[model samples]
Target chain A: MLAVDMAGETVRAMNGSMVAYDGEMTFKRQGMTGGEGLRGALRRRVAGESMTLMEVTGQGTVYFASEATEVTLVELAGDTLLVESDSLLALDGRLQTGVQFIGLRGMGTGQGLATTKVEGQGTVAILSDGPAIALEVAPGTPLCVDPHAYVAHRGQLQQDVVTDVNWRTVLGQGSGESVQFRYQGHGLVYVQPAERGGILEI
Target chain B: MTSTTFNAATLPANDNVNPYAFSVDLNGQWFTQKGKMIAYYGQIRFQALSAGPLDMLVAESFHSPLYAHDWIVAEGQGKLLLADRGFDINSYDLDKGNLTIRAANLLAFEPGLELKQSIIPGFLTLIGTGRFVAASNGPVHFVEPPIRVDPQALLGWADCPSPCHHYDHGYVRGVLGAARMMFGVGGTSGEEHQFDFTGEGTVLIQSSEHVTSSDAMLRELEGQIGMLGVPGLRQLHGTIAQRLAAEQQH
Candidate 1:
């Protein structure tokens, strides 16, 4: 559960994710574009990374939850966070949500070829099957993550899909660890303990 | 509550970073089950057990030919994180001792431990000194035996020499019991059968009774089918057909 204390400040959350509020509050569903204007709506439609958000303005504490999954709050200071639309829960109104192309890294998880990018300043809450572990990447140390477990990433990182195909894979005796996402640069990557069963068995 | 962000330097070395994930400070190599690795930092290389470079290590520590394909060797420097389908993961340390665990529950173990196939068809045994991680449906409880545990709840046993099938004799004695066994007409308590364990050792049981997928059991049956002659195979096919028909009706 996440509690947001507001003194008449506005926040945008996943539609219908508000569980309860202690103060005077009003929720208005942000239409097709998710408050990103007509261009964002069109982009979302084409990219297939649709996010339905609602504006919540209140004066007291409000609670938000989804599927009883654990929530992790990430505070951003102008850096961009690239996350799957399904994993995004809520974020402050100041953050701008946009779509970015992520290539085949998203193919394994059946999440399409793009991801939602959140920029600007404010706190964003993302959901995960379990608690999310944040791993740091630097020039000296690159990180390899299973695509199914990757939730979000921030900073100046370059990610590419690494496919390890050998003769065994041709014999139908492929090692399940055949595909991975290699992240290099300086940033933090968030991964959940559980893998989202998808096209990639691993 | 706010949780601390763990970076490469903050991640624990060979310890659980949380209840559901474990971080291995991999300076050398660790044998990890397939699909259990969530993320990792540093220069780690994952090679299948059959990979040429790992042939020598596989010969020394891994002995289960049936499951060799299901494991990989993770070698190099940095911290490697592993988890199994969001199940509760716990690490166990062995000091020249042996512990057998459900095949699906064993996630990753240090190369110092020798892994062998247990006598029990769906279980794996680890011997020698080292740390290994296993996942349970719920928190695991350790109980001393001379005890009978529901088959679904028995996770594994450590140093217990005897673990055999035990049936409630009273429920299977008379003519009625014989009829019930022959035909699926009567309803018997599902707990009528259990795994009985004895000797000096600890028995591990998950709080929840959920069992892992039955792929291991299916594989074991497939291996044994080779011993059956044509007539035996025909009978087995007939039995399976009957069972399938009954299931469809339900």
Candidate 2:
């Protein structure tokens, strides 16, 4: 659970994520066009990345929670965060949210063909099955992460699909770690300790 | 929890990042269960146990034919992170000892240990001096035997004789009890059955009675069906169909 103090400032949160509030607060459903406007809504609709958010404006502290999952707060400063729409919980109202096409790499990960891009300045709250671990991706040390456990990533990093598939995979005797996201450059990758079953799980 | 960032240099060598995840500093090889690896840094290569190059290593240490397809050998130098369905993961060291664990709970083990199928169904025994990782639904409790534990809560036992099924006395005490058991009419307290353990050694039990789903267990059951012959197989098929029909009704 996350408690956000509001002093007349607004925060956009996941729909129905508000568990309780101490003072007066009003939640207005984000309009037909998401917070990013019609362009983001159209891209999200096209890419199958849909997020339902509500604008919370009040004078007191509001608590947000979703299904008792653990929450991770990422403070972004003019950098972009690529996260799954389903994992997004809440974010500062000042941030801009959009959808970015992540190409074929997303297909093998079971995260779809696009991911929600959160940019601008403020904290973005993401949910994970367990506490998310942050791994630093530096110049020479590339990180390979199971797509199913991947939560979110930020910084100037290049994400590529690394495949170790061979005839063994075809014979149903392949290593389950055949598909992975190889992240390089400079950035931090957040991965949940638990894996969300993906296409490769079979 | 505050997010602490770990780089390849800082990731622990053969240790846990938290209660739910473990990190292995892989220099040579680690036998890992399929789909347990969450992430890793540095250079690493995952090969199927059936792969040709790993034939010698697997033949020496891995003896469980029933679980061959469910395992892979991660070979190379890197920091490997492993987790299982968000369960609490812990690494246990075997100093030239034997330990049997639920097949579904065993995540990965060092190549120094020899893994074989235990006599008990849905359990595997590791013999040798090495390290292995296992995940439990909750914190694992170690208790001495002369104890009866909920079957679902029993993780595994070390250096002890296998346990036997123990049913509550009330389950068969009277005519009313017998009738209720036969018809399945009355609601059960769900605490009548337990695993009775005795003799020396330690018994491991998870705090929760929730067992992870195991397709391997189903396969083990299927493998044992071969000895039943035609008549017994037919009877078992009929019984299973009836059970499936009953389940669908609910």
Candidate 3:
């Protein structure tokens, strides 16, 4: 659970995520486009990265939690954070949310063809099935991760879907580690310890 | 609580990042169960146990032919992270000692250790001096022998002889009890049987009684099914159908 001290400032949070609060507060459901006007709404609908955010303004403190999952707070300054829509919990109202094409990495994970990109300066809280580990990606040090365990990533990193097909896989005795997402360049990748089963195999 | 961000330089070398994750300082090779790897930094290559290049290494360290398909060899240099379904993960170090763990609970181990299939149907034994990681439904409790543990809660035992099945025959010896056992009419307490261990070694049990799905058990049973003749196979099918019908009625 995350508690935030509010002083009349508004924050964007996942709809129906508020668990408890003290003092006076008001929550207003965000529009279909996430307050990005008609054009942004159209893009979100087209890209299938739909997010239902609510504007919360209050005086004392407000608590937010979803499904008792662990929450990680990330501070961003003029950088882009690419996260799954279902994993996003809450973020500063000043941050911009948009859809970005993420290629075929989402093919097997059932997360759609695009991911939610959060940009600007503020703190964002993301949820994971378990505690998420942040791994560094640097020059000549590429990171390979299972698609079902990937949570989010930030910075200038190039990602490619790496498929390792061998004769055993063709013969119906495939090892379960055939597909992975390879990340290179400079960035940080967040992965949960457990895989989101049913969406992807291996 | 203030959260710390970790990079490749900051991540631990052959230790746990947290209770749910373990990081291996992979400079050489490690045997990891398939799909347990969450992420890794640096260069690491995962090959199936059946891969030809790993034949020599598999022959030397791994001895479980029944579960060869469920394991893979991770080779190269980097920090490899492993976890299992978000279960509580802990690393154990064995120094010239042997430890037998439930096959589902065993996650990954260094190449220095030799792995063999335990006498128990769903357990594996590790020998030599190296660190291996295992997952449990909750924090593991180590207790001395002369204890009876529910089979579902049994994680593994170290340096101990295999346990024997103990059943409460007194509770199921009469005519009514025999009828309940045969037709599944009356409900048993589900605790009529347990694994009784009595020795001078440590027996490990998880706090929670939840057992992970056992795919290896199915494979083992399939392997043994080949021993039956055509008539025996037909009889087995009839029994399975009757059991399924009973289960659905409940």
Q: Which stretches of candidate 1 lie over 4 Å from their true place?
A: B185-187
Candidate 2's C-alpha runs over 4 A off are A199-202, B241-250
Task: Between candidates 2 and 3, name the one with more favorable TM-score.
Answer: 2
**What TM-score, computed on C-alpha atoms, does each candidate reach?**
0.95, 0.96, 0.95
Instruction: Please provide, for model 3 over B1-250, each residue's C-alpha lDDT reduced to its tens digit, 9 standing for 90 to 100.
Output: 2256677778888888988998888899999998899888777888888888888999889998998888888998888889888899999999999999999999999888999988778899999999999999999999999999999999999988899999898657898888977766676788898999987999999999899987999887887789998998999999999889978997
Here, model 3's chain A TM-score works out at 0.96
- Candidate 2, residue B99: the lDDT equals 94
Best by DockQ: 2
lDDT of 2: 0.92
TM-score of chain A of 2: 0.97
Model 1: fnat (fraction of native contacts): 0.71
Candidate 1, residues A1-202: lDDT per residue as tens digits?
Answer: 8999999889999988999999799999987768788998888898888788899997999999999999999999999999999899999988999999877677767989889999999999999998988888888788899988999999999998888877877775666777889999999899999988997564
- Candidate 1 structure quality by residue, lDDT tens digits, B1-250: 4467777898998889999999999999999988888988887878878788888899999998888878888889988999987899999999999999999899999989999988788999999999999999989999999999997898999998859999898668898888877884577878888999989999999998898885777777787899999999999999999999999998
**Ten-residue stretch with the least lDDT total in model 3 chain A:** A168-177
CA RMSD of all predictions: 1.8, 1.7, 1.8
**Per-residue lDDT of candidate 2, residues A1-202 (tens digit):** 9999999998999999999999989999999897777887888899998889999998999999999999999999999999998999999999999999999888866778999999999999999999999999999999999989999999999999899888888888889888899999999999999988676653
Error of 1 at B149 (Å): 1.0
What is the lDDT for A180 in model 3? 87
